[model samples]
Target: MSTFPDYYALLGVSKTATTDEIRQAYKKESLRTHPDRLTKATVEERKVATEKFQAVADAYYVLSDPSRRSEYDILYRTKAGNKSSDPGSSQNFFSQFANMFAGASTGAGTGAGPHGAMPGHQPDANGVFADVFEELLRPEVERVVPWWSYLGAACGAGLGFIIANIPGVMVGAYAGNRLGAIRDAKGKSVAVVFLSLGGSQKAAILRALALKVLGSAGM
Candidate 1:
């Protein structure tokens, strides 16, 4: 029952594609979804593309590493299936836990990142973040937010922060405005601003594109 991904499809390459082919595919896709180059599009549009782009980044990040790629391949093949466990084997629960936790922080799982858990834990979290970015880019998914929701989270009021994080970059501006008043046509409601990297249009758009591509994939 293990779920598996057609890694070749993820990279837009055939299964017979060479290592260089994979690398080239990744590079081409990366440039296509670069966020900084998305000035013409709305913030939401850029975010979706970014999420798709991140998927590619993560896939390439793993596929490029031999050991990790092997592990990923094994995991993908058996992720939805089960096998007999070896009691006498050295691999144990602790080791498996360590593998899952890896670079993730303790608090990260309690309620961190997009998953309400740590990285590499729930595929859903990946999907959620990826969904946000994907929606941002798609012309059909223009789910814009009010100006207050983004900026008002800092207030003592019991408002929720709906702005999405773009990995290591600054928060967007939609999350920067004051928390109050009715929505205005001229209000700051751009999706890219919530990530705070809107000023650096080129870099932000590239990231958004990368992430969007990443989320479009299935594993």
Candidate 2:
């Protein structure tokens, strides 16, 4: 008998959920179940996390596509319809689809759910990389902070550099001590060294700081 997976329940979203809501839930769930997050876990734990991650990815791939989602809904309703009727029927629509899917995969199913395989023949070696790339490219509303916040930090760093460069102070001591202070408080220092020179050198420092902030935020 063919089995119809509950795509909505698997995604932890209601049947009536909006597209954006489904996408958000999928991102949150996938990140939580991602295998990379369980590096220190036991073997069994890693196995389970992989399965769960694939399931969430499968759910998102279907629900995010308008045509596939409509087709899935139809199958979902038909299965529901079957359950409410007599159980003596010789065959069901889903069972046929399931059989066809098995034949297509030639019994070596992708770990993704029955319907979740990408279109065409994807070489196994590249599947995981493709999935990660797609996830990163998907736009979402969540961000650690606005772009302007990083800009402000860069500005603050520049202003501090100017104030520390008063004519009487030795440039090396001022830059080294300021860097040490940053290191002591944060337990790490920015990799790029900033010089106290008041011209293009200062511009380079500010640019480095801005890039550092953006990198820290995973932009």
Candidate 3:
């Protein structure tokens, strides 16, 4: 039997928590644990974030549905009761929903990235990042003022996430001391490595940075 992750624990929620509470937890955790948000982190850190983000999504998906949540609650209770004697026992919950959670892990179930693509098949990192950004920000934007025009902002955010996290592209203090830099329109000093971008790409990066900053500030 597969090890069933503690869905409530993963979401930082309780069995008695309300739907809205679970959702709020999911959104907050998703923002924090999203792999793109950890671009500057080490590979090990990124891996942990990826797994955590996936688990958060999984927890939300199961608990949001009444029937699924009921099934999970039973298993969770069983595991808790049998924890001491059979420390290795866990429901086959993972196997039953492997495909569903797997899709979420790959950025597919959320429709943030390409759909209908096989698992582990990421043909274009740029497109993947772009889609992920759009999906991440869509819920918040729609909540205030739903508009298609926001797609432009999402595209820019996606590109920014990718460039900011690109492997070997260090920034902040480390890069500040070594790479030096050029200032963009926003007056933020961009690393020299990104000087290759054209005017349009540069603008997109800046726009993304601005949106990210505002979003984080709860604007």
Candidate 4:
């Protein structure tokens, strides 16, 4: 129903935030995005803050619920707009999603220079991973995702479970640090070369870090 979410933006957390980190993020967002805190803000800003607060709350609500998180995992993979019937699509999608969120390898840095859209911003044989990463943060129940960064979309990070709501994603998740990418059901290009995961715990970290990067970038 909304744009893709920046989970970190929603909760005011960082991309590398941990569970405890997210908890702290939720608390901070609860304070900042709260309607009560916007007394002097413009009516429009207050309304926006209210919405962001709700989004944060909703994300926290879901991610906090394990069962809900499983469902979210399923949804994130299965909801591909063009993926009509790839029985394995969900599994494949999660594999890729997990990998990309990891960011560059441990010592490797993959940040785009802040001069403004760099060489990667241009549409190419492979859609820019940075753009794809930015797109994933948008929170859309059902809609074509967006590419731009968000101002406060990552609050939903606190509610990571709600990000996809799929069950048993661990089954398909393999062990490795490899290229991360995205593609439509039709096999159109999306993104290539993201990050690799050490495991689920690492995946969580990467996911958090991705959000933080997007947030800091003001996406």
- Look at candidate 2 and give me any clashing residue pairs: none
- Write candidate 3's Cα lDDT for 86-205 as tens digits: 111212344454334333333333322342223323123223223334444333333332222344344444554567764323333344322222212223212221234444443344
Using TM-score as the measure, which candidate wins? 3
Tally clashing residue pairs in candidate 3: 0
Residue 98 miss distance in model 3 (angstroms): 5.3
**For candidate 4, which ten residues in a row score worst on lDDT?**
172-181
Local distance difference test values of all predictions, in order: 0.43, 0.45, 0.46, 0.35
* Candidate 3 worst ten-residue window by lDDT: 82-91
Q: Write the per-residue lDDT of candidate 2 for residues 59-168, one digit (tens) a residue.
A: 66556656556766877787773332111121233334333333232222232333235343212211331333332322211121123434444555555557675432
Candidate 1 regions with alpha-carbon error over 4 angstroms: 1-6, 79-219
Tell me how candidate 1 scores on lDDT: 0.43
Off by over 4 Å in 4: 1-9, 12-18, 78-219
lDDT measured at residue 96 in model 4 versus the true structure, 0 to 100: 40
RMSD of 4: 23.9
Query: Candidate 4's residue-wise lDDT over 49-116, tens digit each?
Result: 65655555444433333443344445545444443222133233333443332332211112222211
Off by over 4 Å in 2: 81-117, 120-219
lDDT, candidate 1, 1-219, per-residue tens: 222444445568764566566666766565565555566779888787665555555544445445445665665565444332221111222234326434544332122344323344422323223323443443311223343544443341222223333421233332334323233224433333334434454345445455555543221
Rank the models by lDDT, top first: 3, 2, 1, 4
